[model samples]
Target: MKIISPCRVHMGLIDMNGSVGRIDGGIGATLDYPNCEIVGKESNEIEIEFSSSISNKTAEEDLKALYNRMYTSANNILNKIGQTGISLKLKEVIPAHTGLGSGTQVSLSTGKLTSSIYGYNLDAYSIAQLTGRGGTSGIGVSGFEYGGFIVDGGHTFGRNAEKIDYKPSSASKNVKTAPLLFRHNFDWDVVLTIPKIPVEEQVADKKEVDIFKKFCPVPEIDVNRFCRLVLMKMMPAIIENNMKSFGECINEIQGLGFKGAEVQLQKSTLKNLLIHLQNISYSGLSSFGPTIYSLGDKKEIIEYSNEFFDREGLEGDIIISKGNNTGYKLI
Candidate 1:
């Protein structure tokens, strides 16, 4: 069995304050490029091989922890089903720690392949829970389940809520997957620019937790406006295929609370690049990003980006990918 999973670009965190009755509201979509592909079949024991198509990259030591996490998740699922033998090969991987939901995609892909090789019927959400994902934002999980433009209704507030801390999904464990409030087939071509930057600048783990601790409990007013932009503007624009309105909402999102703070935390170069790109096309930072994505005319955006990169003497990977309407597939 082989599973191919879509990569996602997290537009931004919509709401962090549970004041509106939910803790996290997020928006993102799955991309057709830079996907993770896993091929596996029954074996005497679990054996795994991993590689990537991005620049002919191999899984580095940095990915070891993630690899182990996926293995453990798959093992747990296999144990539940009384099956334990498989040989897994990761043919391609979305670049990790770039806010493209690499971990979730890999883990879910592992779980699905393992389950299928063992003759077990499993859904992606269950695969997510078993793999310890979808804690705060369901964007990644939703992207895995049914690819498209997605908005997740976050966890409910109060003491008994499963989410006690504001942290990234990697640090979050044992939380219910957020509900999918909206999904629409998005047909825009997204241009993704991933700048090469030092590892220290990429927000994750402790730094991510600190950012949340200091900046979270985002003001309700900002949250409300964000909701309005997503609900009243973005969703409608997506349905109507109005790129202008959709692009406008994408530009305005950074001014909102959590997204605003995230932008504030970005390095000066990245911050400038975001502004520069948004001027010509609809652009936003993808999750703790060094990856800035723009959605609009593919040809125009790519041409503009090529000119801008040369003009600014900047170097990065630029990929043009379409939004995925159907989720992960087994081939």
Candidate 2:
């Protein structure tokens, strides 16, 4: 089976620091940028190949570890499913690091493909239970399921997917599930800044927020809050075409994310870049470090970026795209 999944962006993400139980905690998340892609191929033998503008030129020290990320990620999935005997293949256009959710996309995509290899007899969440890919940020996993402007309710605890607990299994009753997956329309457009450097490191990944190990979102944000922020605020802005309010909401989300102080936004050369471009509307840095964005400037953000990059003598790539209201696909 050849499965492809798109990457997802968290406009505003709040790490719980593992405060709530497996089912209870305050949840804070927002769509940062637009998306990423995950492409997978199930093979007879375990072989992995990856290519990006920077893959061939990663830092010498990071080379070995990078290879392991690609290799071990595959081995780990195949091995966990008793498919260690089989090898899987994956390819991506999103470069490693660079403030893009490359790693999450890669791992969850691998998990999805591995599950598909199991003939869908197993669900992605089950694989997640084994691999821990969608513990907090299941949006990427949801994106893998079906790309779109989504309000992903990251998983809550469940009993091995066995319905024995749903109701007393009187006289050997049958339990089945048809989990309804939903994706909403998001109207915002975003400008993606592909910085020159390849394999940009994540500033916050180093701090390692294991908050999920301690807390859950049952206490904080839930479907209702998600609906308000996403539907009431985010969706209306996107639909009504309110760019400024949309921009402000995105900015507000980022501010909330920094409250823990664990999500670091180390300064980049873009400091002056952001200052100079501040006059223009719709833009901010995604995640942490590298790839500063000028969101929702569809008409001519590309041309503006070129002129600014030329003026600053900084090389960058401009991706004029909107929220992909669908998931990943392969050509």
Candidate 3:
């Protein structure tokens, strides 16, 4: 069985960590874009073969840890339940360390497919919980379960709520991750530009989150101000096909996210490349590091990017991606 999970770019992030007793913010939207693919092939012994293009960028120990974790997690989940020994080979395409959630995608897909192949009958939510790959925010898990244009409820997941686990639970039994509420409502098209640069995640970990709680323990406001930027500004604009709102928000969020996560950002040729694009784009920094997503009309984006490249000599691989509605799925 094989599973492929697409990646996403967050438009605007709001610090909703106040509710969860943490400091991580809530994201406005997750645009479907580049995705990571994983394949699970059952084998006789307890052996797993992992091959991924992003492995070139993944730290050796981390890579081993990821594989070991998945293998052990899967074995524990399935074998203990049914004694089914399964083998997996991870086939990856999405670039890693670019803030594309490559690791989460791979892990989510692997878990989903493994469950399906063994006929364990695990639902999508259960699949996400079983993997522990999308904790950065439930949106990734939500995206894994659903697809395009979604807002995973915050504060709930961060509260150590058993309901949010990928595995099935009583609290979240009938939850569907897809856009069932608005099946044909939203069309999201995003252009993903990945410059071969290192990017790191910029968020407070568990420990840091604790420190944040200590420093800033305030009441939870409606966050309407921030949501205004997303819903009143970006959402309506997207529905109406407005470019200005999209660009403004996109550019602004990128810059803010960059400033928030500079220390862990891996080195890349992005800043220099951005110069060529600046004149023509509302580009901003993407998750963790080196992937910059530019939001604009399809024509304008192409036009400006080409103009910048030709006129200013910018070089890097660019992927023109349409907003993905398919979040995570098994094939």
Q: Whole-model Cα lDDT per candidate?
A: 0.84, 0.48, 0.54
Q: Which structure is stronger by lDDT: 1 or 3?
A: 1
TM-score of decoy 2: 0.67
**Rank order (by lDDT, best first):** 1, 3, 2
* Poorly placed runs, candidate 1 (over 4 Å): 52-56, 311-313
The model with the greater TM-score, 1 or 3, is: 1
lDDT of 3 at 58: 66
Tens digit of lDDT per residue, candidate 1, span 1-331? 8999999988878888776566886999999888989899888778877655533564465567656966787787888788866788888888887888888898888998899887787988888888888988899899998999999988876677767667767677888788999999988888998877777777888888888899988898998899899999999999999999999999998778898898889988788888888878889988888788897667777787777677777777889888998989988
Could you give the candidate ranking by TM-score, starting with the highest? Answer: 1, 3, 2
* lDDT tens readout by residue for model 2, 126-242: 544544454444555555555554444332335553221111101112222113234555546566766575334444342333332222232344323433555567656656767
Which residue runs does candidate 2 get wrong by more than 4 Å? 14-44, 51-63, 152-182, 196-204, 208-232, 239-241, 257-264, 275-278
TM-scores for every predicted model: 0.95, 0.67, 0.70
Question: Model 3: residues >4 Å from true position, as ranges?
Answer: 16-25, 28-33, 51-66, 156-188, 198-224, 254-279, 297-316
Q: Write the per-residue lDDT of candidate 3 for residues 1-331, one digit (tens) a residue.
A: 6777777664433443345543333353345446666677665655666675657666786677667766765765675356566777766646555666665566666667777776666755666566554443455666666666654443334345422322211123333332122211236555566644322333324433443334333224434445456556666666777777766765544444213333223334456554445556676655544666765565776666565456555554667776656666667
Candidate 3 vs. true structure, TM-score = 0.70
Q: Which ten residues in a row have the lowest lDDT in candidate 1?
A: 51-60
